[model samples]
Target chain A: MLTYIVEDDPVAAYLAELMIRKEQFCSEVQSYVNGQRAFDSLKEANETGGALPDVILLDLNMPLMDGWDFLDAFDSLAIAKDVCVFVVTSSIRPDDIEKTTHYKHVRGFFSKPIDEKALKRMQHLLEVPNN
Target chain B: MRTPDYLQAELLDLAVADATLFNFLHGTVLDGLWYWDLQAPENGWVNSKLWLTLGHDAQHLPPEPNAWQAALLPADFATMQQVVAAKAADAACHTFSQVLRFHRLDGSEVWMDCRALLLRNEAGTATRLVGALLNITREVEKEAYAVEIANHYSTILSNQSVYIIKTDAAGNYTYVNDLFYERFGYDAQIIGTSSLNSIIEEDRPKCLDVVAQCFVEPEVPHQVILRKPYNNGPVKSNHWEFKGLVDEQGQVTEILCVGYDVTLLTENLQKSQHLLEVTKQQNLRLQNFAYIISHNIRSHSANLTSLAKLLDGNGNADQKAIFLQMLNTSTAKLAETIANLNDIVTINTQGAIAKEPRLLKEEIIKTLDALNVQIRQHQIRVEVDVPADLLVPVVPAYLDSILLNLLSNAVKYRATERPAFIRLYTYQEPGFIVLAVQDNGLGIDLNRNRNKVFGMYKTFHNNDDARGMGLFISKNQVEAMQGRIEIESQTDVGSTFKVFFSTNVDVDLYS
Candidate 1:
C-alpha cells in the first residue's frame, strides 16, 4: 500500500514517516509540505493515470492552503478508487473534529503525533472488508 | 282711533302727573333705587323695592351712608368701597357699576348689579347720588360655579409638576404656569414671544409642525420631542403633547401644551443599548481568544511531544541531534505565545488607562522616525495631512505601539511594481478624533482573510517577520483605551485604517 503525509511541519512529517516505516504499514510513503502541493500532485496523478495512494494523512492548519480547502477541491475530482483520508490536528476544538464528518472520504480524526494504538486501529480497519 | 272715556282719562293723567309716572317707574320698571344727597347727608331716601326684597320696611326710609352695612356681605362691601366708590363724585367721573352681594331677611345671599350716577351742582361737587340696583343673583351664581370648576381644573394642571403652556394660534406664548417658570427657569417674559424660540434650533421645525397640526386638526392631539437649552446646565429634553383649544364658535383659538422631561429616560436607554452592544462584542472577542489560545499552545506542544518521543527511542546520533533542535524551537514558540497572552490579559485586568493630550503631528513624527529605516529601504514616500497641533487624548504607550504597527505594516507590505506612498490624515467627528493611515502597498486579501487578519498566529503573506500577533495586540490595546479601529480595503487595492480617539470621556465606542 502507498500512503501520503500532507503536513506543514517537516519534523512532524519525518516522525510519521519513521513510525510507518518501522511498523511496515505500507509498501512506500511520500510527503508533501502543504495542502496545495499535495492537491496538485493528486490532480496530476489522476489526469495521467499515475499511481494513487491508498491512504492520506491530512493536517487541518497550514499556510497557503488548509485541509478544509484541500477537501473542498478534492471533492470535485472523479476517482475510481476509494482512498481513506484521516485528519490530524493539534487543535482541541470539538468543532474541527465534528467538521470532518461532512466528507465521505474522511475515515477518522486524531490528535497530533499519531500513536501506536491509533496505528493498530488503522491496521485493523484495513483488514476489515468493505462490506 | 276712538278711545273709551276711562282709557283716555288714564292716558291724560300719565301726561299731567309726572310724579305719579316716576312712582310707577320706581315700583315696576326699576328693581331698586336710592338717592343720597351729599349736600345734606341726613336727607337720603331708599325706595320700597330696595328693602322690600329683603322683607324689611323700606317705604321712603331714610338711607344714611351706613344704612346698607348690615345687609351687604362684608367682603363684597369692602370690594365695592374700594372699586365702585373710589372715583370722586365729579362731572368727569360720575357713573360707577359693580356686582355686589347682600343678605335677605332669611339670611340667604343676593347679588345686585348696582349702577350709580352722580348729580353734580354748579360747583362741580357731588350733591345727589342716584344708584339703581338690579337683582343679578342667578347670573352671579352661574358665573361663580363656572369659576369654581375652572379653579378645580387649574389646580390639577398646575400642581402635577409638568410644563403647562398656552399659546395663541400664532405660536406666541399666552401663558406658562408657575411650575414651568419655577422648574425650567423661565418667567412671564416668555409671554407674547414665539414658543419656538425656547426650543433648541434643531427641534424648532418639529415644534412648528406640532403647533400647525394643532391648528389644522384641532381635535386630534399632537406630540413632539423638543430639546430645551438652558443657561446654566446641560440641554434638557421634554416630551410635549399639544392640543388645540377652540372657542364657542368652534374655531381653534389657542394651543394648550403639556410637557414631561424625558432627558434621563432617553440617556438611560442610550446607555443600556450601548452597554449591550459592547457586551456582545466582548463575548465574541472572548470566544476568539479562547479558540486562538487553545490552538497556539497545542501546536507548539504537539511538536514537542513528537520530538521527545523520537529522542527517547533508540535513534542514530544525528537523528537525536535533529530532534533536540526541533524541541528547542518548539519551546521557544510556546514561550512567545505565553508572553503574548499575558499582554492581552493585562488589557482586561488593568483599571482605566491613563491618557494624555499629545499633538497628533508630533506623534506621527515620532512614529515615522522609528520606521525610518524600513521607509528608506522600501523608498516609500510619506504624506501628512494633519494639523501642526491637533490634540488627541490617548495613552502614550498605546499610541506609540499602534502607530508603530500601522506605519511599519505599510512599509512591510509595499508593492514593488510602482512607487510606494503612504498618507497620514487626521479629522474630527462629533466627539472623536480620527487618525487615518492610507497606504499604496500589497493590500490584504480582505474578502478571503478579513476575519483572520487580526487572529493570533495567522500569517497570510508567509513573510519571515509575519508573526500575525501585531494586529491582535493592537486591537486589544485600542479597546483598552476605550477607542476603536476600523479597516477599509479591497483585494489588490490599498487599505485605510481609521483609529478614533474619543474627545469626550462620556462618549462610548459603540455609541
Candidate 2:
C-alpha cells in the first residue's frame, strides 16, 4: 500500500510519517508540506502512468492551496482506481466535518496527532476494499 | 278786454300753484332735488328732501350752497366742484353724474349718486342746472365686502411659504405666487411657458402621465419632484403635489402645484440607510470571527490531547524524542495562536480608541525604518510620495502596527524574479484621509480568496512565515482608531492596500 500525508507543519508531517512507518500500514509513505505539492505530485504521477497512492491524509489549513482547493482540483481528475482520502485535520469544527461530505472520495475525518488507536483504525480501513 | 292789474294778479296765482305742485313731486320720490341758476347770486334752490337725506330736519338746514357743502365730506366737495366746472365749460355736455358721500347730523355718512342735466334758455346759453340725488348705501357696502375677500386670499397666496403655481389646460404656467418664484428661482418670464418642462428629464415621463391622469380625474391630485437647476451649488430636492382645477362644468381648465423642499430629509434618510448597511457588515464579520476563534482553539486542544495519548503509549527512545520535539512545537504554536486571538478580542471589546492628528509621512517613515533589515534583504526600492503636513487621525500604536504589517507584507510576498518595489502615498478623499501602500509583489488571487484575505489563519501564499494574522490584526487595529482598510490586487501584477482614517476624529491632547 502507498500513502501520502499533506500537512503544513513539518513536525506534524514527520510524526504522521513516522507513525505510518512504525505501524507498517503501507509499503511506501510520502509527506508534503502543503496541499499544492501533493496535488502537483498526484498530477505528475497521472501523466507519467506511475502508481498512485492508495490512501491520502489531507490537512485543512496550509499555505498555498488548502485542503478544500485540493479536493476541488482532485475531483475533476479522471482516474480508473478509487483512492481513499481521509481528512486528518486539527479542526473539530462541525463545518469542517460537514464539508467532507462534499467529496465522494473522502472516507473518514480524524483529529490531529494520529495516535496508536487511530492508526489501527486507519489500517483496518486500508484493508477493507471500496471503503 | 281785462285791466293790466287784474291780469297780473291772476298770473301770480297761477305761478304760485305751479310751484306748489313741482315741490310736491320732488319731495315724494326723489331723496333730494337741486336747481342751480348760473345767473343768480345764491348758489341754488334745494328742496326739503335734501335735509331729509342728510338725516336732519328741514327747519335746521339753511337751503344755501355753503350749508350743503358743509354736509358733504371734504374729499367729495372738490370732486363735486370739478363736475360742475366741466358741465359749465361744455354746453353740449347735458348730463353730469357722480357718487359722493354726505355726512348726516347723526354722525353717519350716506353714499349718494347725483345726476344732473343742463337746462338751456332760448338763446342756447345754460341758465339753470337740475339734478336728482339717490341713496346708494347698500350697493356700496356689498361692493366693499367683495373687495375685502379678494384682498384676504391674495395676501395668503403671496405670503405662504409653500410653492404655489397655477397652469393652464395646456400645462403652461398662468400664475406663480411670490413664494413659488422665490423658492424655485423663477420669475414672471416663466408664465405662459410649459410648467412640466421644469421637471427633471428622468421624472418627466412619469410627471406627464400623472398630469394626464389628473385631466381624466379632476378630483385626484398628482405628486412629483421638480429639480431646481443649481448654478455650481448643492442640489436642492423638492417634492411637489399637483391637483387639477376644474371649472363649473367639471372640465379640467387649470393645475395647481404646491410643494416644499425635501433635500435635508432625503439626505438624512440616505445617511441612516448607509449606517444600517455598515452595522450589518460589522455583525457578519463578528460572527465569522467567532467561528474562526472556536475552530482554531479546538484544533490546538485536539493536537495536545493526541500528543498526550501518544506519550502514554509505549515507544522507543528515538521515537519518543521525536514525539517530544513535536509536542513542544505544537504547544508553542498553540500559545502563539492564543496570543493573536487575545489581541483581536482586546481590540474588538475596547471599541474606538483615543485618536490624535499625526503626520502620515512620519508614520510611514517610522514603519520603513523598523523594516529596514527586511527591505535590505529583499533589495526593495521604496518610494514615498506624501505631503509633509498631511495629517490623519489615528491612535499612535495602531498606526504603527498597520503600517508595519503592510510594509512587511509587501516585502514578504515579493516575486523573486524581479527586484521588489514599494510605493507609499497619502491623499485626501471625501470624509477621510487615505494612506495607500502599493507594491509590485506576488499579488493575491482576489476572485478565489476575496472573503478570506483578512481572515485569521487564512494564508493563500506558500511562504514559510505566512501565518495569515498580519492583515487580520491590522484590520482590527485600524477599526479601533475609527479607520478601515481596502485592498486591490491582481495575480502576479501588484497589490495596493488603502487605509482610510476618518477626518472628523476627536483629537487627543497628549499625543
Candidate 3:
C-alpha cells in the first residue's frame, strides 16, 4: 500500500514522512506541503490504472486550500472509495475533534508530531480488509 | 329740663329717638341692631328684620331672661358669661353692653353688635337697661373666607418640588417655600428675614440682574443660569425663568422666579464627548489593521505567484528545481500568514468569553523547548524565576501563542553587542499577578512610540522576522482574558514586559 503526507509545515511534514517510511506503515510514501497538489495527484492516480494510496495523512492548517476545504472539494471529485483520510493537526481543540468525526471519509484524528505508535496502529488497521 | 306731664313725655320720646336715630343713618355695611331691658329681660328685642331674613320668628322665642345665650356656640359660652357678670355687678352703672348671640325661634344664630344704655334714678340705682345689637355676620364670614383661601395656597406652595421664590418689587425674597428651604439646605424660619441672595450668593447676582431686565420690560420673562453650591460641595447649575410681578400702577414690586435643575444635561454632554473620542481612536485602529492585512498577505501571495510562474516557464533543470522549491516555501509561508489571520478573525467574532485553563509554567517551558536551537545558537542565558505553582487562568491555545510570541521576539531581536539574557518572573501585585518578561535585547524607543507598540502591524526594528502580528495578537489575547500588558523599555538597555492577570478566576483560583 502507498501512503501520502500533506502538511504545510516543512519540518512537521518531513517528520511525518520519515515516521511512516521507517515503520513500513505503507509500501511507498509521498509528501506534499499543501492539499491542492496532493489532491491533483490523487485524481491523476484514479484515472490511470493503478491502486490508490491506502491512507492519506491530511494536515488542517495550510495555505489557500486547508484540510477541511480540501476534503469538501475532494468528496465531489469521486476519485476512489476505499482510501481513508486521517486529519493530523497540532490543534487540540475540542471543536476540531467534534468536526472531523462527522466526515464519512475520515478515519481518525491525530495530533502532531505523529509518533511510531500511531504509525504502527495505522499499519495494522490498513492491513485489515474492509467488510 | 322737665316740662309739664305731656311735654315731659314728648321730651323723653325725643331723647330716645335721638339715641336710636343712628340706626336709620345707615351706610353700605352689613350691621344690624338689637335692644334689651334688664328689669324686664324677656322684653329683649333682637334685630328682628335681620333674623327674619335668616329664617327666624320673633314671637316663639324662649321667654327666659337670658334665653338668647343658647344661640352662643358652646366654645363662646364661657366668654359671654364673663361679660354679662361684669356688667351686672353695679346696678348704678350707666352703661352695660355685650356682643352676644340671639337664638331666634327658628333655631338660627346671627352675630350681633350689642350696646346698652342704662336708666338710673336720683339715688343712682338702675331701673332698666336698653341694649342694641348690630348684625356683623357678613364681615366675619368674608374675613374667614379670605384666610381659608390663603391657607390652601400655602399648602400648594409647600408641597411643590420646584423652588418657588416670591420677591418684592426690590427683588428681595419675601417668601421661599418649604421645598426651597429643604433643597437648598436652609431653615424654614428663613422665609422673610434672609432673602434668596443670602443662601445662594453666587447665583443671586445673576438672578437679580435677570429680574431687573424683566422689570424694565414688562411681560417679558427673563431666563438665567443659576449655579449654586450644594451640600455635597459641588456647584449645582439650574435654569431659572423669572416672571416679574407688577402692580396696577405699573411698578415692579416682586419677581416670581421658577428654577429647574439641569445637572444631568451637563453630565450627558460630557459623556457624549468622551464617546466621540473613543470612537475616533477605534476608527484609527481599524484602519491600521486593514493596512497590515493587505500589505503582509499581498507580499507573500505575490512572491508565490511570481515563483510559480518562473517554474512553469522555461528554465534549466536546477533552476526549475530551485524555483519550484522557492514557490513551495512561499506558498507555505502564505498559508501560515492566512492561518494566523484566521485565528485573529475567530477571536474577533466570538460573542462570549473563553473557558480555557493554561498552566503558566508548562506553556513557558514548551515555548523555550521549541526555541531551544536558537537559544543554543545565541549562547543566551535564560533565567525563569517564576513560582513553580503559578498557573494563569487563560485559554490554553491563546496563552501558549502569547508567551511563545513574546519569548521568540526577545530571542530574535537580541542586541548585537551583548550576549542575550532573558528573564521571566511572576509575583503578586495589589490586584493581579505581575508576570514580567525581561530581555537585554535591542530595547524599543518607548517614548517615541509609547502607545503604538501593541498596535496592529506596528514594528520599530528592521528585523526581517518582525511581521508585527505577534505583539498585536498577544495584546488581543491578553485583553480577551481581562488582563493588561504594559512595557518599560529604553533604547540600548533592555525591555521589560509586565502582564497583569486578575486573580479572581473562579474555575481555578490558584491551583
Candidate 4:
C-alpha cells in the first residue's frame, strides 16, 4: 500500500509521514506541503500505470492551494477511484462535518489531536476500501 | 305765520335798511337766504355775506334768473333744472336740499348742501325762489379717512398666509384672517361672530388652555402648539406644530403659528431607530464570534502543546507515532483559523472599492461547476436560472467568493434522507438586482441565530467538522462590493439567501 499526504505545515506533514510509516500502513509514504504539487505528482502517477496511494490524509486550510481545491482538481483527473481520503482538521464547526457528505471519495472526518485509536480506525476503513 | 304781503314787503325793506335788525335775524337763522328774479339779473339779494362763500352772488343778479342752475356743479345740473321746473308750477311752499360740488372762483372745490323754498302766485305757480347753500366738505373728508384705515388693515389680514387672530380676554376671537379659514376649513362669515373656543376642538384643548393662561396672566406670551393632521392626504398619520403668538399688552391674546409638514421626517426617524437596533444585534454576534475563535484556537494550541510533550517523553514507538500525528493535525487547524481571522480583519479595516463590471450569471455557473463533484455525489439538482445578460456592479474576486460560499453551503447542508435540490435565479427589482440561492437543506433557525450565522467561528450545530468561517467571509465580501445579503430559513426545511446589488451595468465607481 502507498499513502499520499497533502498539508502546508511542514511539521504536521513530517509527523503524519512518520506515523504512517511506523504503523506499517504503506510500503512507500510521500508528502507534499501544497496541494498543487501533490496534484501534479498524482497526475504523473496516473500516466505511469504505477500503484496509486491506498490512503490519502488531507488538511483543508492551506496556502496557494488547499485540500478542498485539490479535491476539486483531483475529481477531474482520471485516477483510481478506490483511493480513500480522510479529513483531519481542528475545526469542530457543524458546517464542516456536514460538508464531508458532499464528497463520495471521503471516508470520514477526524478532529485534531488524532491519537492511535483514530488512526487505527482510519486504517480499517482504508483496508476495506471503496470500489 | 304770514302777515299781509304788503306789510311783509314793507317790513323786509325796513329791516334791510336797519343794520341792528338785519344782524339780529342773521345771528338766529340756521340757513343763509338769498333771492333772485328774471326781471333784474344783476339785482339779486342775499341777507348775509356768509352765503357768498359757497359760489353765490349777493348783488346784481336777475330777479327771475336761473341762479340755481349757474351755481350748480356740472354733476347736479340736470337734477337742479327738473326740481326748479316742478316748483314753478305749484302754489305750495316747497323746500328741498341737494348735495353738489361747488367750484369756487379760486378753482378750489367744496361740497355744498343747498336748500330751496318756492313761493307761488294765485294760479299755483312760483313767483320767486329763495335758497341756502352750506359748505360740508370737511365733514365728508374726515369720514372717508377713517374708512380708508380700516380697509388697509383688513386687506393685509385677509391676504396673508400666517394665522392672524385677535381674541378678547376671555379667549373669544374678535377677528381671524383668511388663513384661519383655509387651515380649519371654516367659513369666514361663520367665524366672524363665533368664539375661538368653538373651532378649537377637544383634541386641541391644550392649545386653548395655553391661550387662556396667557390672557389671565397679562405678561406671559402664549406658546401654543396647533397640531393639525397631515394635510392633503389620507394615508398619513402625522401632525404639524406651530409656535409663538402674543397679544397687545405683551400677553398672548391669540396663538399665531406657521410650520411645514413633517410626515417624512417622522417616518425617517422610525427607520433610523430600526437600523440602529439591527446594528446592535450584529455587534453582539461579532463579539460572540471573537470569543468562539479565541476558545477554538486555544483548544488547538493546547492540544499541540500536550502532544509535543508526549513526543518528548521516552515512550514506545506506537505512542510516539500517535502523539506526533496529533501534533500535526492540531497545528494545521491552528494555521487555518489564523488565516480566517486575517480575512475578517482585512474586510473591516480597509475601505473597499469594487469598480469592475462582473456578469452575475456567469459567476454563479462557475461556482456551481467548481462544486460539480459535490453536486453529483449528493445526487443534487442545481437549477441555474439567472439570465445570461444580467450584470452587476462588483469586483470579480468578491463576486466569485460570494457565489462559491453560497453554492457550497447548499450542497453541504442537504437533507440526508432525500435528494438535494438548489435553485439559483436573478431578477431585476426597482433600483436593484436580486440574486437568490435557495436550497433544500437542513435549514437554520433564523429567528434564533440568523444574526450570528455570518459571525466568525460561530456555529449552530454540534457537527465536529464545522469551521463556521465560510458564511462570515461571504458576508464580508458581499458587503465590500456594496451589496446586501438576506437569509430566510427554518430548521430541517431549507434556506434561501438573497443578494442585492445595483443593477446599473455602466456604473463608473472611479468617479
Candidate 5:
C-alpha cells in the first residue's frame, strides 16, 4: 500500500511518515508540507499512468492551502484510484469535526498524536473489502 | 256750550303744547314709550322711539297694546306679567321694573329694562298704565362673559397634573395646588415657610440663585431640580420651571413655580444606561473568547501534538534526548497557556464584582512594592504624582492587578540605552476618574499593532517573559468594574496607559 501525509508542520509530517513506514502499513510513504503541493502531484498522477497513494492523511491548517480546499479540488478530479482520506487535526472544535460530513471521500476523523491503536484501526479498515 | 272760535283755537293750542312736552321727555330718557288705556285697548299709544329700538320704520308699527306684546318673546312676556301682578298686589309699589327680552318687527330680539307705572283716578281705581323701555343687551352679554372666563381657569387649576405653587417675594409658600401636595407630601404647614429649604443640600445654592434671579427679572423663567424628602420612601425628584408673577405696575408680586415629578424618569434612564454598558461588555468578552480559542488554545495544542508524535518515533540516543527535552518544553507551554486561558475566562464570565471607593495612591504604591526587586535591578525611576486621598470607584483586586500589570510591563520593555522612567498620575474628567501610567521605554509601533496590542498571546517584543496575556487580562479586569483602558504610544519614545473609572459608581446596577 502507498500513502501520503499532507501536514503544515514539518515535525508532524515526519512523524507520520515514520509511523507508516515502521508499521509497514504502506509500501511507500510520501509527504507534502501543504495541501496545494499534494493536490498538484495527485493531478499529475491522474493525468499520467503514475501510481497514486491508496490512503491520505490530511491536516486542516496550513499556510499555502488547507485540507478543505484540497478536498474540493480532489473531488473534482475524475481519478479512479479509490483513495481514502482521513482528517488528522489537533483542533477538537466541534465546527471542524462537523465539516467532515460534507466530503464523501473522508473515511474517518482522527484527533492528533495518532497512537498504535488508531493506526491498527486504520489498517483494519484498509483490509476490509470495498473500503 | 260752544265758545267763540278764538276761545276754541286757544284750547286746541293748549292740548298740543301738552302733547309735545310729553313726547320730548319720553324720547330723551327712554328708548320707547307706550300708554295703555284699559277702556279702549286697541287705541293704545306708542312713541317713534319704539320703532327705532325695534329696528323698523315707524310707519310699520301698529298703535295698539297687543302689537307691543306680540313683539316680545313669549318667556319675557310671562315674566312681565309676573312683575305687573306683583306690583298690582301692593298698590304702594306703584312702579314695576323688569328686564325682558322683546322681539322686534324685523324678527330679532333685544334685551330691555322696562319700567311701568300704574295711573289711578281720583276714586283710587287703577285705569291707564304707562311704561318706559331701555335697551340693556350690552350689559347682559358682558356679565355672561365674566362668568365663563372664571369657570375655565378654575377647571385647569383643579384637574391638571402640573404642580402649581405660589410663593411670596421672600420665598415663603403662599399657595400650593392639589398636585403639589400629592407629589411632595407637603401639608398646609408648609405654607408661610421658606420653600427653598426643601431642595437637597448639595443643590440648595443653585436653587437659591435661580430664585433670586427670577425675582430680579420677573416673568423670565428659570429651571431647577428640587428634592422632596418623605418619611419612609425615597426622595422625590421634581423638575420645576419658576417665574415671577408680576403686577400691572411691573413689581414682582409672587414666585410662580410649575413642576412635575421626575423620579421615575431619572431611575429608568439610569437603569437603561447600566443595561447598555453591560451589553457592550458582554459583546467584548464574547469576541475575546473567540480569539483565545482560535489562536492561544489551538497553537498550544498543535505544538503538544507535534511534540508527542516526535517522541513516539525512533531516533538516535542524542536525537531522542533532544526530542524529549522539546517534548517537556512543549508540555509545559501547553499547561501554562491553558492556565492563562482559564484565568481570562473566569474574569470574563464571573458575576458582578464588588466595587468601592479605593485610594489610587495606595494601589499604585502596593504595585510598586510588589515590583521593587525588578525596579531596583533595572534602576528604574518611578514618579507618583497622584493625591493620597483621590478616590476611584473600583474593585480592589482588579485595581491591584491592573497596576501590577502596567508597572511590570514598563520594566520588562525598558530601552536598552537609557534607564527606565515611569510616572503615575490621576486627574478628573467630565464623569470619570482617570489614572494614567506613563513609561519611558521601548514603545510599540501602534500603526502596525494597534489592533493586536490588547489581544491574547500577541507578543510584540522579543522577550522570553512576554507572554502577551498581561494587557489582555488587565483590560478585561478594568472593564469588569465598569471602567475602560486607553493607550497612546509611539514607536520608540514611550507609552501611556490611561484607565478611567466612573465617578458615580454607587448606583445599584448589578444589585
Candidate 6:
C-alpha cells in the first residue's frame, strides 16, 4: 500500500518518511511539502487513474493551502476512494482541533511526536500489534 | 247667539295672550324684552331689566331704541343699524341677532346678546319690532381669562433657555417650539414624528429606558444624557429631564422634556472612559499573548532538549550531525521568537512614543538602500514618489522597521511569473499624511482573511520562512506612533499598505 505524508516542515516530513520506511508499514511512501501540492497530486492522480495512497498523514499549519483548506477542496472532489486522513498538528489548540477534523475520511486527530492515539489507530488500520 | 258667556270668556283670554306670551319669554331665559313701534319710529318701549342690568335707573332713561344705542360702542351701534335696515328692506328676513357691548353706569363694560323679531302688515312692510337683551358678560369674562392663562404658559415655555418638547405617551412629538426647531435645525415638518428617531442609535435603549421610567412613575422625574443627531452637525449629547403629564385618571397622557446640550461637558469624560476600556481589552489580549508565547517557545526549547538526548545516545556520525543541525535550528528559532516578543512588548507599553521629524523621501531612500541586495538579486524594481520637502514626525526606529517589513514582504511573496515591483508614495489628506506602499506580488485573499490580516502570527501563504511576526509588529509600531495602518489587497493581483499619520494629533502633542 502507498502512504503519503503531507507536511510543510522538511525535517519533520523527512523524519516521518524514514520511520515509515524503517517500520516497513507500506510498500511505497511519498512526501509532500504542503497541502496544496498534496491536493494537486491527489487531483491529478484521480484524473489520470494513478495509484492512490491508502493513508494520508496531514499537517495543519503550512504556508499555502493549510490542511483544513485542503480537506475542504478534497471533500468537494467527492473522490470514491476511501483513503483515511489522520491530522498531525504541532499545536495542541483545542479550538483548532474542534474544526474541520471531523470529515468522514479523517480517521483520527493527533499532536506532534506521533502520540499513542495515532499509533494505536495506525496499528488498527494496518492490522499490526504494537511491539 | 253673539252674547254667550263662554264666548265672552274666550274673547277675554285672547285679549291677554300677548302679555302672557311676553311674560313666558322673560321668565324662562331670565332676561328682559322691548317692544318698538317701527311705523311711528319714536315709540320704542324699553324694559326695566335691560337698564338695571347696566346698573342704571330706568326712570331716568327714555323709551327709545336710540337711548340704548347711545350706550353701545360706535362700531356695535353701526352693526345694529345694519341688521335693522336689512330686515326692513327684505321682509322675508324675520329675525336677527348681534352681540353688543355697552358702557355700564359705573364705567365698566357689559356685553349683551340681543335677538329681535320683526312683525309686518299685509303689505309686507315692517310695522312693529320686538327684541330680547340677554346678560352674557360673565361668560365672555371666563373665555378671556382662559385665553390669558394659555398665553402666559406658552410664553414661559417658549422663552426658556433650554429645549422644550412635548410628546404623547408613545414618545411622538406633539409640540416643538421655535427654539427647539432652531437649536436642532429641523423644519416644522418634524411634528408628529417620533422623538426616538432623532436620538443616535447607540443611546436609543437608554433613552427608551428613561422615558419609560418617567411614564411608569409619573410623579417622579427622570433625567439622563442621551446622544441626539443634529442636522449638519456632530451628534450632540444632551442632558434631558423628562416628566410625564397625566390625565385625571392618573394615567400618563403625554411627556414633557427639557434638555440642553452637554456634548462639550461629556466629551473628555467619554474619552477617558474609552481609554479605560481599551486598557481592559489589552489586559485580556495579554492572556492570549502569553498563551501563544508559551506554545511557540516551549515547543522549540523542548525539541532542542530532546535532540540533545538523542545525540548523546550511541548514534553514528551521520545521525549525530543531523541531530546537531536540528538542535541549531531549534535554538535559533527560539531566539528569534524571543526577540520578536521583546519588540512587541516595547510597542505595547508605549504611552506617548517620542517622535522626531524626518523627511519622507529621505527615509524611503534609506529603507530602499537597505533592501537593495534583495531587490537586485530578485530582479524586483523599486519606485519612490514621496515629496522632497514633506517631513513627518515619527519614531525613526519604528519607521525603519515598518519599511523593512513591508519591503521584505513584497520581495518574499513575489509571484515568479510576473515582474515584481514595489512602489512607495506619500500624499496629504485633510488631517493626515498617508504613506502608501504598492506592490505587484502574491496578494492575500482578503475575502477569506480580511479580519485576520493584522492578527498575530496569521500567515496565509506557503512560504515557511515566514514567521508571521512582521506585519503584526509593523501594525503595533504604527499604532504606537499615534498612527494607523490599512491594507487593500486582492487574491491574484497585488496589495497596497497605507500608514496614516495624523497631522492634527502630532502637531498638538509636540507643539
Whole-model lDDT values for every prediction: 0.81, 0.81, 0.70, 0.67, 0.79, 0.79
Looking only at chain B, model 4 earns a TM-score of 0.51
Residue B45 in candidate 6 has what lDDT? 70
Per-model DockQ against the true two-chain complex: 0.45, 0.31, 0.01, 0.03, 0.05, 0.16
**Candidate 2 segments whose C-alpha is farther than 4 A from its true place:** A1-33, A44-61, A81-131, B1-148, B196-206, B215-218, B229-234, B244-253, B301-335, B348-354, B374-393, B411-451, B478-511
- The CA-based lDDT of model 5 is what? 0.79
Model 2 has an lDDT value of 0.81
Candidate 4 Cα deviation (angstroms), residue B406:
3.5
> In terms of DockQ, which candidate is strongest?
1
The digit string of per-residue lDDT tens for model 1 on B71-157 reads 778898677556634555335888988787778877888888889787877888766778788988888789899999999998977
Residue pairs that clash (backbone atoms under 3 angstroms), model 6: A63-B461, A63-B462, A64-B461, A64-B462
Q: Each candidate's TM vs. the true structure?
A: 0.58, 0.63, 0.49, 0.44, 0.45, 0.58
- Model 6, A41-125: lDDT tens digits are 9999999999999889998766567787888888988688878888876666666677745676776777665533455668586
| Proportion of the native interface contacts kept in model 4 | 0.03
Better of 3 and 5 by DockQ: 5
> Chain B TM-score in candidate 5, rounded to 2 decimals?
0.53
Q: What value does the interface RMSD of model 5 take?
A: 6.6
User: Candidate 4: where is the Cα deviation over 4 Å?
Assistant: A1-131, B1-48, B51-73, B76-79, B82-93, B103-108, B164-179, B182-184, B188-219, B225-374, B381-405, B412-484, B488-511
lDDT of 3 by residue, B12-99 (tens): 7876878553545321133443454555544555444544534546574345555444555665556644565466567646665566
Writing each residue's lDDT as its tens digit, candidate 3 over A1-131 gives: 78788876565565566557667677788888677778888888788866577789998755435687678877877765588888877555566779997787787888666777777776666667644
Candidate 2: tens digits of C-alpha lDDT, residues B429-488: 898888899998999999877877887777877666678889999988876676689999
Cα deviation at B161, candidate 6, in Å, is 14
- Categorize the docking of model 6: incorrect
Candidate 3 docking quality: incorrect, acceptable, medium or high: incorrect
Model 5 per-residue lDDT tens digits across residues B363-419:
889889999998998899999999999988888888888888899898888766877
DockQ of 2: 0.31
TM-score of chain A of 2: 0.94
